[model samples]
Each structure stands twice: as structure tokens, then as C-alpha cells.
Target: MIQNRSLARRGAAVVAAGAAALVLAACGGDGDSDSSAGHGGHKATASASASSSASASASQGQRNAADVAFAQGMIPHHRQAVEMAGLASGRAQSAEVSKLAADIRKAQDPEIKTLSGWLTSWGEDVPAKGAMDHSAHDMGGMMTDGEMTELENASGKAFDTAFMKLMIKHHEGAVEMAKTEQADGAYGPATRMAGEIITSQSAEIEQMNKLLGKD
Candidate 1:
């Protein structure tokens, strides 16, 4: 009878060991499932974060019609300013006026390229490079062919005076366009350019007035 009781106890121990092994296996599977689920969740979150970032970047640089117009109009306008500046050295008498012309050329030339680049990137039309006829466009500060011709014909102090008068008007026109962009343009870079034009050219206008002895 003692031997039979010993056998029964052994059988019970075997059953208990098997049950414990099964429980451990089940727990291990649960752990693996939880780990896999956590990894999947992380991947999903990363994908969502990446998508949101791309969306934000695209939206921030988006342009409107006003922005397009501002860029397009400014390109030719800046070109004209650069052209006018080029004419100053041979004709202008005032050292200050000559320096101012050089400065205007240096500043607006790069800005013209920048504005053109913006339009190209936006899939918009870049203004044609040439003697742009401003008659058709409502851009402010545009010099007529006659005005430019007249200025070109002048010499010495006469040229300096004409340059100052024309440039002041040109700067005023740029200011008007810039203010319009500041109010209505949607592209961040273009609008900022507009504001810079207003600030810088307005100061230049004041300087031109001084050059003209009007300030």
C-alpha cells in the first residue's frame, strides 16, 4: 500500500509539472504578442508624424494669385531699376547720385533673380527678359521710353537731377506694389521681399529727395 501511494504522488507531480510548463509557454506567447503590437503602434505613429510634417512644409510655402502677380510684376520693375542705375554712371554728376545708382543696381539685380526663381518654382510665368513695356501693366514707377530717352540725353547736373526725380518716382511705385503684396500676398518669402522693398526703397526715396535738395 505504501508503494501504491508513492506512485500516485509521482503521477500528481508529473501532471503539475506539465501544467506549469504549459502556463509558461502561454505567458511567453502573450509577451511576444504584446511586444509585436507595441512595435506596430510605434510604426503607425512614425508614419503619421512624417505625413503631418510633409503637409505642414507644403502648406507653409503655398502661393496665391496675389503672390504670383507680385513676383511677376516686381521682376520687370526691378529690371527697370537696374537698367536706370546702369545709365547713371556716364551721365550723373553728383558723386552721391552715382554711388546711389551703383547701390540700387547691386541690390535690385539679385532681387530680380530671386523673384524670378520664385515664379519659376511656382510653375508660373517668369516675365520675359528684354525692354519690358510697362504701358500695358499697371505697375507703379514705370518709366516711359520717352522719359528714359530724355534722361539718357541729359548730362552732368542735368542728368543727376533727372535721375533723382525719376528714381524717386520709381521708388514710390515700388512702395505701392510692395504695400499691396504685404496686404494680400500669400507666399511668405514673396511677402517678406515686398516688405523689404517698402522699407529699403522708402529710405532711398528720402535720400533721393535730399539729393534733389527737396529734403
Candidate 2:
């Protein structure tokens, strides 16, 4: 009887030891699975962040190209118009014509300054101080030195008539140039200015035509 009881107690202790070992093995497997899951989550987050940063960089590069072209083209165009406006101030005879020239000079000079600043900020060159090749015939409403001299020498109604005629043609040419930029230019600000020029100059051209009829 005593031997049988000792045997039963030893059997119970062996079973308990086996159960404990099984429990420890299960805990170790669960810990490994959790660690692997954490590593995978970290990798996914890193990949997402890298993709987002690349997209932002590409968008900014596109905007930069547009801004640069707008500043470069518009500066030269505005400069020529301002030169023409200056001629009008001294040569125009009618009070209305003189007022129009003054307004054009005032509006365009400040715009020139603004465009110059944009070019500087973009690290682009401002248009140099020379006449651009603006004509296929060398007479696309562009006043040569001789033509300007002729206008400058005239007085009274003749001056007014000549100035209005020249300016009407000049504005037409500017409108054409602005249309080109609006169609093909890349930057938002530049394209917008080009549209404005087309609208305003077209209206002025009509006014100048009326002035022509008066004479």
C-alpha cells in the first residue's frame, strides 16, 4: 500500500513539470510574433513618409519654372511700352491724350518695378537696356529714332494726331504680344498680367480710333 502511494505522488509531479514546460514554450512563440509585427508596422510608416515628401518636392519644382519665365518675358515688354508712354507725355496735345499717357506711365512704371523684383527674387536676369527684335519688317509699330524725331518736331493738332495714331498701333502690337504670353507662358502671375494687358489695351485702341475720327 505505501509503495503504491509513493508511485502515484511521483507520477503527479512529472505531469505538472511537463505542463509548465508547454506553457513556457507558448509564451516564447507569442513574444516573437509581437516583435515581428512591430517591425513590419515601422517599415510601412517609413515608406509612406518618403512617398509624401517626394510628391511635395515635385510640385514645388513645377511652380518655380513658371515663375521664372513670367518675370523674364514681361519685364522687357513693359519697358518698351513705358518708353512709348514717355514719348506721348511730351508730344500729345489734347488734354485727354495727355492724361491717358500719364496714366499709362504711372501704371506701367510701378508694374516694371514689381516685375523686376520678382526677377531678382527668382535669380533671373532682367531684360537688358537695348531694343529687342520685335519686328519681322522692322516696322511693326516700333518707332525708330527717325520716326520718333519726326513726332517730336511736330506741334498742335499734328502732334496730337501723330501721337494718337502711333500709340494706337503701339497698343495693338502690345496686345498681340500679351496674347502670346497668355497662351504659352507658364506662370500664374505672368499669365494673369498678360490677360489684363489684352483687355485694357484693346479698350484703349478703340478710344484712340475715336480720336482719329475726330481729326
Candidate 3:
């Protein structure tokens, strides 16, 4: 009877050991599953962050391109107009002609500075110092050096008449260019400014024509 009792106890011990082993295996499996799930979550978060970064980078690049082109094109255009205005201010005999030139200079100088600031911010080259190919693009009403010289040498009524004629042409050209930009320019600020220029310059053109009795 003692032997039989000892055998029964041994059998019970074996069953308990098997049950413990099974429990340990289940716990290990649960740990592995949790670890795998955490790794997957990390991967998903990393992918989302990467996509967001790429989208932001693309948007910034587009903005930079638009800003650069606007500054590059506009700087030279403004410089030429300012030069013409300076000549008009000095040589124009009519009060209307002088005032118009002064107004142009006032408006354009600030615009030039604003555009230059954008160029600097974008790390783009400012206006090139050399002579630009005004002929390459239909730069409206741009005078040659000879034409400007003639205007500078004229006096009295001739100066007034010539200044009015030249300035009218200049403003017309600018209006056309501004219209082009309004249609095609990429940035919000640049397109808006282009529209404004078109409206303002068109009105100025009409005023100058009226002043010259050409209306």
C-alpha cells in the first residue's frame, strides 16, 4: 500500500510539472506578440512623419521658385523706369510731367526695395548690373540711350512734350508686363501685385495722355 501511494504521488508531480511548462510557454508567446505589435506601431508612425516632411519640403520649394522669378524679372524693369523718371524730373518743364515722374519714382522705389528683400530672403541674385536685352522681350516704351540723351538735352516745351510721350510709352509697356505676370505668376503676393500694377499704370497712362492733350 505505501509503494502504491508513492507511485500515485509521482504521477501527480509529473502532471503538475507539465501544466507549469505549458503556462510558461503561453506567457512567452504573449510577450512576443506584444513586442511585434509595438514594432509595427513604431513603423507606421515613422512613415507618416516622413510623408508630412516631404509634402512641406515640396511646398516650400514651389514658393521659393515663384518668389525668385518675380524678384529677378521685376528688379530690372523697376530700375529702367526709375532712370527714366529721374530724367523726366530734371528735364520736364510742365508741372504735370514733373509730378507724374515724381509719383512714379515714389511708387517704384518702395516696390524695388520690397522685391529686393524677397530676393535676399530666397538667396537669389539681385538685378544684374549690365545692360539687359530689352529687345529680347517686348519691353514696352523702353528708350534707347540716344533717345534718353535727346530728352535730356531738350528744353522748355520740347522737354515737356517729349517727356510726356516717352513716359506714356513706358507706362504702357509696364502695364503689359504686369498683365502677363498676373496671368502666369505663381506666388499669391506677386500675382496680386501684378494685378495692382496693371490697374494703376493703365489709369496713369490715360492721365498722361490727357495731360499731353492726346486723349
Q: For each predicted model, how many residue pairs clash, with residues at least 3 apart or on different chains?
A: 0, 0, 0
Clash count, predicted structure 2: 0
lDDT string, candidate 1, 72-103, tens digits: 88888888889889998778888999999999
Query: lDDT ranking from best to worst?
Result: 1, 3, 2
TM-score of each: 0.83, 0.64, 0.66
Give per-residue CA lDDT, model 2, range 50-99, as digits (tens): 99997775544334554565566556656766776677655667888887
Candidate 3 segments whose C-alpha is farther than 4 A from its true place? 1-69, 133-138
Report lDDT (CA) for all predictions. Answer: 0.88, 0.72, 0.77
lDDT of 2 at 81: 60
Q: All predictions: root-mean-square deviation over Cα?
A: 2.9, 5.3, 4.8
Error of 2 at 193 (Å): 1.0
Q: Write the per-residue lDDT of candidate 3 for residues 139-206, one digit (tens) a residue.
A: 66677777778887887789888877887787787787777766666666667777878887888889
Please state the error at residue 194 of candidate 3 in Å.
0.7
Model 2 bad stretches (over 4 Å) = 1-73, 130-140
